[model samples]
Target: MQINCTVIIQAFNFLITYLFLRKFFFHPTVQLIKQKDTAKKILAEKLKLKELAVSNLVAKKNSDLDAFRYSISQRYQKPEQAVIQIEPNVLSKQEVIVSPEVIEECKNSILKGVHNAL
Candidate 1:
């Protein structure tokens, strides 16, 4: 009977020790993990906001550049120079005519080629 009482006392002591360790260590470990999660969430939100602002700024700058390009093209656009023609008699005195000697030279070249083939 005495040995049964001793065993029950030992079991009760072990239960109390287990409960104390859980209260002192496990509870704080859980709280620290929760704090770390919240910090990560806040940091992610801030980075997302910064990225969105940069994207909006780039879009606005590109739009401005496009508008400037359109305005410049419209201002300088004009018809081609071919819209006007010169008079038929322009530089009538200065025009050089090819002589019959040039035509004879071309004829001699063709004759020489025919001679080589035969």
Candidate 2:
């Protein structure tokens, strides 16, 4: 039950410090964190949109290339190579892509088989 001058002064000092920190330090720090979160979200959305655009462009390019190949194959029809036209359907259905080296090896093996048959 001792009410002194020092206790009152100390209580007032504590209140002022709390108010100053809340206004200058805590509020600004919280606002900065919110701003950074919003910036990251905006960047992520932009990246996703760009990725979608790139994927669409790639799909269009692939379709155009396929159309060009089909047109060329049709224009250059060889009567002597009727097997090639028939084989393309089977190869397209398989969707198998082999390297040029593998194709060369396969050609060599076919030629050897033809020679052995002869």
What lDDT tens digits, residue by residue, belong to model 2 across residues 1-118?
8899999999999999999999999999999999999999999999999999999999999999999999999998754522322234545656688999979987997776666554
Worst 10 residues of 1 by lDDT: 78-87
- RMSD, model 1, all Cα superposed? 13.4
lDDT (Cα atoms) of all candidates against the true structure? 0.81, 0.86
Least well predicted 10-residue stretch by lDDT in candidate 2:
81-90
5-58, model 1: which lDDT tens digit per residue? 878889999999889878998888999999999999999999999999999999
Give model 2's TM-score versus the native structure.
0.61
Instruction: Give the count of colliding residue pairs in each prediction.
Output: 0, 0
For candidate 1, give the lDDT of residue 97. 67
> Candidate 1: TM-score?
0.57
User: What would the TM-scores of all predictions be?
Assistant: 0.57, 0.61
